[model samples]
Target: MALITALGPITIDMYLPTFPDIAQDLQVSSHEIELTVSSYLLGLSVAQLFIGPITDRYGRKKPLLFGLGLYLLATISCALAPSFDMLLVSRTLQAFGAAACIVIPRAVIRDHYSTQEAAHALSLLMLIMGLAPVLAPMAGSFLGPIIGWRGLFAVMLVVAVLLIILCIIKLEESLKPENAVKLSAKTISSNYFGLLRHRNFMAFALSGGLGMAGLFSFIASSPTIFITQFGIAPENFGFFFGLNAGGLILGSQISVRMLRKHPSFSVLKIALLLGLGCCAIGLLLTLTGLMNLSLFVICMFFFSACLGVINPNATALALKEQGGRLGVASALMGCMLFLFGTLTSSLVSSWQTGTTLPLFTSLFVCIGISFICGRFVGRA
Candidate 1:
């Protein structure tokens, strides 16, 4: 489960360090390379809309295998992409394939655990998933010079193959026969729209989604910001990125410990408020021109830590309210994440003004709205 969950994060982060190289090799601007990221996220969101229902009807193992097969092909396409446009398309398809990796595990978790247990399980998963962010960029940076950006995609191709093999050998269907629902257009529509009206679910989903968007805002902008603004070398960028990711890992472990005593909902509320405080400090530092690399890293570390608390607890609370049809519920939650991720990442890319103000502003607004949304959870 941890390996499957980490697939999406690794795919997203590993290539991040090669943004400049990709842009240069493809004769595109850095902004254009960023579009590939946005495209991948958009594809992730859209694909989950359909994949969720399919998983519910077809069972987890079949759909998961199918998605992994598609992901493997898409990775090869990405490796051989000759133009920026081709890379954009390939990345989108790769996301389509990778969407299963994001959705199925949450559904499986929902199948086995209650709210708190699920959160604890997810926190453990996050400990493993967290390593992707810490390691992927560093690996990318080191390998990029040796093999070029295309070689990085080639590496992803190998990883995808390994994941496919691992799934075939070890992964079992978690979706029970009794829980299976028949698929129909109307059924799919009803399932999805019903979730839309579910206030508690929507609250936690959007709260978690917006928090994820804030995180992606950092991910999308950091390469350009660090390399261009801070004059950090491409090879060295991963160290700083890893440092902030360490904060995220630390926070997840902290939440794991907190869950031993406190309720997930209570932890979520406190974490959201604390995240807002971190955003405020980050914004203050950015606006006052005191946002050097060291201070920026410090502020982001705290904010990332807050996310560690927010994501698992929010996910658990939202999933807890769904009595059945967890696949669709989990899919929608994952969709919300990538949808908001697509929006914030694109906005951060376009809003670049030679300062960190836009990034901080986006982060603050996301966390603030997330807090507002958090208030509505369990109220219904």
Candidate 2:
């Protein structure tokens, strides 16, 4: 499950360091290169809507293998992409395939565990997933000079192949025949609408999604802000990036301990509150032109840490009562989550002002809304 979950982050983080090189090689602007991230996220959001009902109707393993196969092909396409447009297309396809890896695992966890247990399980998953953010950029930075961006895609292709083999051999069918939902347009639409109408589910979904918006805003803008504005060397960029990612990992592990004593929603509330504060400080610093590398990085680290708490707990709360509809529920949650990814990434990419203000402003707005939505989860 960890390896499968790692696919999304690895696909994302591993390519970040190569953005400048890719822009140069493909004869595009940096912002144009950033559009690839937005396109990928858009694909991820849309793909889950279709894949969810299929997974619930069929079983986990088959849809997973099919998606992995598609992912393998998409990775190869990405490696061989001849133009920036082609790279965008390939990345969207890659995200389409990776959506299965993300959506199904949550369903599998919900299939076996209660809400609190699922929250605990998700924190463990984040602990594993968090390594990608730490390691992938480091690897990409090291490899970008040696073999270039294409070589990095070749490496992802290899990982995709291995994941395929692992899934075929090790993964079992998580959804039993008895629990399978009937597949149809009507049922799928109805299920999605029902989830849309669900008050508690929407609260947690928006909370988690808005939190992710802040995270993606940071990710989308950080490369340019650090390497271009701050003049950090690409090779050393991973150290600072990894430090923040490590904070996220540490936060997840800490949440596991907290979950042992406190309820998931309570933990989520506190984390959201803290995250909003961090964003407010960051935004204020930016507005006053007092934002330095040290202060900005510190703010991001704490905000990322808060996300580690917010995401899993929000997911647990949202899907706890989903019952046999876990697949679709997970899908909707993922769709909302990555839709926020799409929005923030595109906004940051298009609105680059050669300043950190836009980044921090977006971050502040996202986390502030997330905190508000999170507060209403229990009330709903």
Candidate 3:
């Protein structure tokens, strides 16, 4: 599950350090290269809309296999693209196919686990998934010089093929046939709409989604901010990037320990509240030109730590709170979550390219919203 979830972030993070190289080779601006991020996110958010119905109707294994097949094809197209336009098109299709890897794993987890066990399982998954950021950029930076940026896509394709084989060999269909929902558009719509209307679902989803949005903003903006603004070398930027991701792993493990003694809700509240304060200070520092790499990394670590704690717990809370149709519920929560990703990523992509102001501002605002949503959720 962690490996499957890692694909989404690895695809985004691995190629970040190769931006300047890609721009030079493809004869494009940094802004144009970043649009590839937006394009992929758009496809991902849209794909989240329907995977629920399909996955629920069929069991987990078939749709997963089907998606991986398309992912392989799209990734191969990405590697071989001769033009920037072709690369963008291929990335969108690649993300559309990769959506299954991101969304279905949660459904699979929710299918068998509940409460503290579910939270613990998800934390373990996140602990592993968090390592992708720690390693992907370094791998890409190391390999980009040797094989060029296009080779990174080829590498991802190889991983996808290998993951598919592993799935075939080891993963069983988790959603039992008798438990699967009967196929129909109305049932799908009803389940989705019902979940959306539940205040608990909306609350946890928004809180978690906002945290994810903050993370996406950081990822989208980091290449420019770290390399172009801070004068970090392409290859060494992974060290700083890995530092923040390492915080996530630490925070997740800490949350796992905290959960053993505390309720998930309290852990979430403390994490988000701390995140808001940290992000606000980060923004203040950026706006005043007091922000250095050390300060930036520190602030980002706390915020991402909060996110690492929030996501799995919030997801477990939302899934456990909703009683029926785990597939649709999971899908809706994922759709909303990536809805935040799509929006924040686009926001970062559209910002003036060289400034860290957007990164700081986006993080501050998103964290603020997360805390506010949590308060309202408690009241609701």
Candidate 4:
């Protein structure tokens, strides 16, 4: 789970500093270059729909290896892409590969652990995984200006090869033969729909999804808000970004300790309330013209910390009810969360006001929805 989740931040953070260069080279608007980011997300989100079921039916190893192989190829394609359209297509394909890495690991964890144990493991996993965004962007900010954006893809290609080798050597089949669901559409639909009909799963999934949307919305707008509006240097963005990532790490670490004492729902509720308060303050600051880059970063840190509490708990709760359908359930939940993220991110990208308004506004709405969902759906 750590490696899988880390891949996304690695891919994203490593290439962000290259955005200006890629834009200038392609003779396009910076927003146009951002489309590549969104395109990758779209591919990742859509591919999870199929990859989940395939992994459930076939066992985790084959699909995971195949996806890594494809990801390697796609990374090379991204490095060699000459035109903007080619890069966009390559990014989308790359996402298909990355999606497998992300979705399968969660299924594996679910397969191996009970609900509380899964949450504890996921919290640990997140503690490690969260470091990627912190370090990756900093690495990119330094390397991007020197090596160019294409070189970042080369790094990803190398990482994919390493992952592939690791998978072949160390990864065992987590899904037992008897537990595997049939791959037919009929079986797939039945499993997926059954999971959907469960109110607890829906509640958990929605709560996590909304929290994720808040983060995604912030990510979509951060570059412009920090760079254009606040006049922060590109080299410095990573440091500030890493601060928020640190908060996430801190929160996840706390979850490990909290799970031993408190109910997961109680933790989730407190986290959501904290998130709502942080976002509200952020919005108030932005709307009232009191927004400073320092203040914004502080608010983001708190907001993301709350998310750290919500995410793993919600996922563990959602996966608790699935006996043989862990993969499909994971896929369904991943798909919905990513779909919401994609929509929220697109909205942030389009509005591009060079201010913190979009960031705070989106966070407020997402948290509000999450809080409401938690109250109604989070009951035992």
Tell me the deviation in Å of residue 125 in model 4: 1.7
Which candidate gets the maximum TM-score versus the true structure? 4
Q: Which residue pairs clash within candidate 2?
A: none
Prediction-by-prediction clash tally? 0, 0, 0, 0
Q: lDDT score, residue 66, model 3?
A: 85
* Residue 334, model 2, lDDT: 94
TM-score of each: 0.93, 0.92, 0.91, 0.94
Error of 3 at 172 (Å): 1.5
RMSD in angstroms between candidate 1 and the native structure over all alpha carbons: 2.1
Off by over 4 Å in 3: 20-30, 286-290, 348-357, 378-380
Better of 1 and 2 by lDDT: 1
lDDT of 2 by residue, 1-380 (tens): 87898999889878887888999999999989978877887899999998899999998889988988899899999999999989999999999999999999998888888888888999988888878878887888788899999999899989989988898888889898998999988899999999999888888888988997787888777878899988899767777777777777878998899999998888999998999899889888888888888997899889889888888888898998787788899999999888887788769878978878888888888888888888965542
Residue 182 accuracy (lDDT) in model 1? 84
Local distance difference test values of all predictions, in order: 0.87, 0.87, 0.82, 0.86
Model 1 residue 22 CA deviation in Å: 4.3
Error of 4 at 218 (Å): 0.8
Report the C-alpha lDDT of model 3 over 72-146, residue by residue, as the tens digit: 999999888888999999999998888888778888888778766677788888887889877887788789899
Q: What order do candidates take by TM-score, descending?
A: 4, 1, 2, 3
lDDT of 1 by residue, 1-380 (tens): 88887888788878877899899989999979978877887899889988899989888999999999999999999999999999999999999999999989888888889899999998888787779877887788788889988999999899889988998999888887877878999989999899999898999999988998998899878978899999998768777877777877888999999999998989999999999998999899888888898888888988988898899898888888775578899899998887788778779988878888989999999999999998755452
Q: Per-residue error at 215 for model 1, in Å? A: 0.9
* Candidate No. with top lDDT: 1
